[model samples]
Target: MTMVTPGSSPSPDPDLVQTILLSLRRKQGTWVAWAQGCQTLQQAKLTPQQIFEETGFEPIQQNQIVVAEQVYQSILKAGLSDKAQAHFDQRGSDLLYELRVLSQADRARVAEFTLKHGLEADEVRELVKPVKEYSYRKENPPGFGDGPGDAIAFHFWKLARQKDDLQDRSRLIAQGLRFADSDGARQQIETLLTDFTVVKEQPAPTLPLYRLETETDLPRIIPVVGQMPLTIDDLKAVPVAVPENPFGMVTFSGTGAWIAVPGWQVIFQSEDPVGLLTRARQLPNYPAEAADEPVLVIVDRANREWQDDGYFLVAQAEQLTMHWSPSPIDAPILGKVVLILRPKRILDEDYNRQPWQLDE
Candidate 1:
């Protein structure tokens, strides 16, 4: 792959790239929403240009710009040099994304937090605390409704697939849904849930097995993509970098591998769950595969996070019994872990996707 240096211009427009990406994402989301019956078209059949023109774009909050103005005013009041204000316009939005949530009332706490953790999202989150009224309340006040109704609607709609009985695809694609105010408004949601089938409930594994690997030819962590595992043989391992302090979140690629971290492992994945089990059976020192029913082998020993009787509600399964637990083997030198995947929503046959297989 060819490397492009910083500030180098590409042949294509950057704004166009962002627009195309945005449109594709919107199309995907809309298709999913239509399948689940969350959206209804506002108008009848229209041309492509009309659809684009009529599509609802959210009002620009200009939050970063507003915060930038406030900061500039504060800087002027402090009698800071003009040079400080010059860089503010370009860098102000960047600072707003990191530090805008800081409460003006808690200036002391904000200073302390910024001094310790720098101006980052984690610092902003750390500095902010729950409202006192909600913190230790025994019961919600009268007329206090549940938060995140829209989120609930979105999640439900995302996971569901349209029923075969439903026709008029174009209408669904264009119409805006009348949210549940009365029974008439709620009919679509009710119908969708009743007709749609969730697919993640069916996994290839019939049984969960706790197997003990007792061999010398140990399995190695293989890199499918470029991502390498964060390996650790020590339980008390500290992050190599000083910036990963307090409540910092480090986002990393989870390439399929038998990764050994201080507390967790990134197990291997396959195109199909059956293929994954098949490969695990072939590995030396790994336990033999189960007969008749396919088994998912989990090796557990010397790990503090292991829980035998626990279950987690995963996105695919959407049930409490579909939770995650550690593997059966925990040998740092001779153990490999198979990746466990959460269930994904089943989409319409017309809207199905295939994983891209690049040359190995």
Candidate 2:
């Protein structure tokens, strides 16, 4: 390892700079040597900025080369087959760079795998994630071998199990089958594909969006005894307050703000329903604009019993909040969150067309 001192050109050699610059320009099939050339220039007290000015190699590229070169060297020292060495000898710098995240031993194994599979740079990048994360998992996936291929297979197998759609699950299972090293792992994934059944998922209930109007039709409060005649200003002097409505209303402002929820759908088997007002952040998958807007979470107060597939409103810190658990909670269960009314985001065509309008 040569020590790099910034701006300390002890002995300036113009020929050496030109030679390295030309080699860097010849960017075909010699990135390993290019990395070494960059190091030589750095050792000669040249900064990465200076190298960039001379050779047009950016600072980030230089960093990738330096780190990747070290990883390549470690792979070489660990030893690879003659064919693997020959393949990596020319090109594959991007492929080797992606392997830097793995351990030295794992890097060697994956380097050979990359060579065997003829993997592209992007494929190598995807392959490194599972290999790097495999060690951190508490337990190894059953029926999978302890190889890089098995690691990839296990990764896809878990994802295949998590998917609800048959198409998505089948695609992931096929991916896992492609990388399954052991027959046991292959059989396990194949079983999922062979025994697949299409169970139609029930559609979620939709509710209409309503605005909370500020104006009220309630009668005005008057003093028990006042002046015989009162002026409009005198009446206006008294503060006005509207009584809270029995049903909650979630409001949204601005044009093109309509969620295309169909007719109101009945929820649960409750006779009476109560509504609570809260922000959209409490719910998952809310739109960015709707994050701050109020939402009416309708629930049945009578249905306080815990249901496996239901969301409940619970009291926490002396405040009402959602309880997302199957089992009973220590806090008081307010009700089941039956219908959530979210405002729709409908862009106005006229407003969107303004950006493309020609100047007058």
Candidate 3:
């Protein structure tokens, strides 16, 4: 086996180095004997002489030897011998051998070791104070009645919902509502109510609409279809005019409003009839693929803030089908008005659910 040279940037095995250092630190007597008997001290070719000269230290002085011996004795007295032995047994012995070769730096290393492992009286107090404070907080949680019991229940409910447990979701909602009724939980209750209403009211469309090109050889005129409920199959069968070049041409209404092209699919119907009509006038294209079922179309009458005031029938159409036939101007479509009314019983039920008047 080749002898490994020290301090030569050799690929030292970390585990071997740890093991050696640990072993050397543990067996103080063995380490001292090895240091005294080191025949290869000169061959180690260390910077000890240069360091000693720079520091102006007399290497053979009796006082220096006494100081070194006292420092080692102090480390031994601090029970470092047993601790170092344990570290060596657990790690390795090469590290201790390396430490022994560093004569001047060994004193600093010993001082560091003592500081790390040996706690002063003040250090012990510093460690205990925070732990005591934490214990107090645990015993007394913030807020009044039952001390964080409801908060704990809410946390558990939330954790349960994350696990996709429907039962836990319902439980949490119920618990949260109850907590809201409590004097201390009113603010949290109001926040939850706002979130529920916002989520429920926001409508997300499944199909996207596209823009229609006017000048392209593709069909420029799309038939203004009726509000009649037509399935996707019916739409597919409806003949459309296709342009030749199919490029750069955009479709627009007489009033400068951009009409949705015939190709896009209709994904959702607005509950507001006026909003639907406004949306229809603005769409330029439709979705290509849609479900085969006809969706409900409401003639939105509530929000009419435009100069072109009229009813709009919204539906999904293919994105590439250029020409629309049987225009909205036909005689049969002009004379009819479709009204969808809510049932009287349903209206009455909603009315009954309303909050009581101030007088009552």
lDDT of 2 by residue, 177-280 (tens): 88778898898888787666543433323233354332231223333335859778777665433223323222233332112222355543664567666676
Per-candidate local distance difference test: 0.30, 0.67, 0.32
lDDT agreement of model 1 with the native:
0.30
Top candidate, metric TM-score: 2
Between prediction 1 and prediction 2, which has the larger TM-score? Answer: 2
Q: Which stretches of candidate 3 lie over 4 Å from their true place?
A: 1-171, 174-218, 222-255, 258-360
Per-model TM-score versus the true fold? 0.17, 0.50, 0.15
**Order the candidates by lDDT, highest first — what do you get?**
2, 3, 1
The alpha-carbon RMSD values of the candidates against the true structure, listed in the order shown, are: 26.4, 17.0, 32.6
lDDT of each residue in 224-277, candidate 3, tens digit only: 444679777767664454332222123333443222222312222333331112
Error of 1 at 20 (Å): 24
